[model samples]
Structures are given as structure tokens and as C-alpha cells.
Target: MNYNKLVKQKRVIIERCFGQMKCRFHILQYVCRIKLENVPKIIIACIVLHNVAKSLGDPDFELVEQDPDEDEGNHENDELPLRQLGQQINKKKLEYYNK
Candidate 1:
């Protein structure tokens, strides 16, 4: 029932949804070539299609496993940038909760 725990749980669900979407809608796995303003509409359409397919009992395509070495580079180099971004987000979340 902790707020942090609830946020983590919701994040897991969201990540799972994205993973499934990427598998079923291969376009999602690639860089979107459309205008940034149109991105949300595209994502919404994909969600609708995904849900409809689920309702119809369509099976999800299995996610193709990529070599981690090919996609994910050295995490050590990313740590500083990620930490800075995470700090900003954490600050905003804390402010929202403190309100």
C-alpha cells in the first residue's frame, strides 16, 4: 500500500504493455517516422488494435530476442545521465505528493 510500491507495480504493468505492443506491432519497436504531434494518435490506434485483437483471442507474436551486447551498450557510461534525469523526475514526483 506504500506509494512507492504502488508506483513500481504500475510501472511494471506499463512496461509489460509496451513489450507486448512491441511484439504484436512491430512498428512500435522501430523509430516512428511521423511528426511528433501525431505520435500520440499513432500510439492510441495501436492500443485500440491491440485490445481488439486481444478481445478476439488473437495470439501475440513472440518477441524476438536480440543480443544484449548489440543493443545495450556499456551501462557504466549511461549511469550519470540516467541518474540526473531520474533525480529531476523524482523531484517532481515528490513535489506532487507533498502538495
Candidate 2:
């Protein structure tokens, strides 16, 4: 048995399930807020609901393939300009020098 193939197969299945779950239930996208005792039940209920919705041909589960790395790309480029920061620092330096 090829380990890499097995891993890839499992990855596809798990990723698809997660994608569908998130697409259908926004609640699953974050941590649970339900009572501690009800957490298990709530999770099962959500999974059941997702499955039923899929079986009923719900279009909400339609997911696009997203590159997880794409989100982290160009994060530095998204940051605020350094010019304002430099100007502020220069003003502070001048104020200190004048003291």
C-alpha cells in the first residue's frame, strides 16, 4: 500500500467534508458557544443537517477550490505604508533633539 496515496485520498475526503461543513454551517467556522454538555449533540446535529441538506440537493454546499496559501500571499503588501510611520518617527526625533 502506498502511504502517500493513502494520505492524499484521506486529505481530499477530509478537506471536502470541512469545506462543505463550513459552506453550509457558519457556526462550524468558529468555536462552539453552546453549553458544554450539548457540544457533542450540537456537532452531531450539524453534521446530520449538512448531510440531509446535501442529500436534498442544497446548493449552499457548492464549494470552490481555494488555495490555503493564497490567503497568506502578499500580506506584507497589504500593510499600511511606511512613509507615515517614518514621518511620525522623524517628528518625534526632532522634538527630542529640540528638548
Candidate 3:
């Protein structure tokens, strides 16, 4: 198979997987309140749940794709300012408390 065609096929499979993941585990779409350190574990768990649901023949999957130009509002903020490390630490602390 052509490399480009293989890549496109993989992308489609990944999109379908994510669609099944989100519908089978609604929590995947929510803003996670857990610490950043735990995010990977949560995501892995969701993937496992998605695969199990798929294997068991659960349906109701929908794919979501973001528009390419939807990030214009954050263009200026893309590069964090040098001084924001302290600000990020403070924000994380606040999020910790809020959760």
C-alpha cells in the first residue's frame, strides 16, 4: 500500500476509536479535575474501556473534528511568556485547592 494511503487509513481508525471511546465513556469528554500526573492513567483506562466496549459490540459512536481555523483567538497566547512559570505554579496550586 502507498504510505500516504496507509497513514490516512490509520487516521480514520484512530478517529473511530476516539468516537467509540467518548460515547462509551462520557467522562472522557469532561474537563478532568485530577492532577496532571494522573491524566495519563485516566486516559489509558478510558482506552481500555473503549476497546472492551467495541469488542462487546456496543454502538452509538460519533466522530468529532475541530475546524483548522478555530484556534485564532489563542495565537498570541501560544508561546507562554518567560515569567509565566511562577504564574503556572500558582494556577496549579489554585486548581488543586478548587478540586
Candidate 4:
């Protein structure tokens, strides 16, 4: 199997983990205003709690979408640069992994 293909396939697991985390912890779905240094700690705490819930055989709930009308903020303008950077990083990773 091509390394890229294998990596892409494995990516779904982490993506699903993120999805599940967002579903379990709605805070993950929205922008959190806090000190920059605490962001990782918050996310790590969520991950730890999520794992604990899973380990305890908690029921998995599907993500429920909030009303579209309630979302008034346009985030595309904010995400464009971040998305571009992510693409650049992904390309670099692919280059390194394919070598």
C-alpha cells in the first residue's frame, strides 16, 4: 500500500475521534476565549475526559447541529489563512513521509 494512502486511511480514525469529542463536549465546536497558554490544557483535559467516558462504556451520541439561523458569524474570512497554512503543513508532511 502507498504510504500516502495508508496515512489517509488512518487519518479517519483521528478525525472520528475529534468528531466524537466535539459531540461529547460541545465546547470543542465553538471558539473558546481564554489565555493562549491554557488552550492546550483545556483540549487535553477534554481528551482525557472523553477517553475516561469511553473507557467507562458511556454511550456515544451523534453530533446535533444547532440552528443554522443562530450562527451569525462568518468564519470563512478568518479560516482562509489558517486553512492555507494547514495545507502547506500537510504538503510538507507528505513530502517527508513519502521520502
Q: Which candidate number would show the highest lDDT if scored against the true structure?
A: 4
Cα lDDT of candidate 3 equals 0.71
Give candidate 3's error at residue 68 in angstroms. 27
lDDT (Cα) of model 2: 0.73
Task: After superposing candidate 3 on the true structure, give the runs of residues whose Cα lies further than 4 Å from its correct spot.
Answer: 63-99
Compared with the true structure, what per-residue lDDT tens digits does model 3 show for residues 1-99? 999999999999888777677776777888978899998898899887566544544444676677997855755664576347547645655665587
**TM-score of each model, paired residue for residue:** 0.57, 0.53, 0.53, 0.61
The TM-score of predicted model 4 comes to: 0.61
- Residues 1-99, model 2: lDDT tens digits: 799999999999888887888877888788877788987787798898777555544445656778877755565753465666556656655665587
- Residue pairs whose backbone atoms clash in candidate 4: none
Query: lDDT tens string, model 1, 1-99?
Result: 999999999999888888999887888899978899998998899999888666545556555778877966577978898788667656655665587
Model 2, residue 96: distance off in Å is 76
Error of 3 at 26 (Å): 2.0
Candidate 4 per-residue C-alpha lDDT over 1-99 given as tens digits, one digit per residue, 9 for 90 to 100: 999999999999889899999988888899988888998998999998787666545556566788978968887698888788667656655665587
Query: Considering summed lDDT, which 10 consecutive residues are worst modelled in model 4?
Result: 52-61
Q: Between which residue pairs do clashes occur in model 1?
A: none
State the lDDT at 15 in candidate 2: 89
Instruction: List clash counts for every candidate, in order.
Output: 0, 0, 0, 0
Instruction: Give the runs in model 1 whose Cα sits over 4 Å from its true position.
Output: 62-99
| Error in Å for residue 52 of model 4 | 0.5
* Candidate 1 vs. true structure, TM-score: 0.57
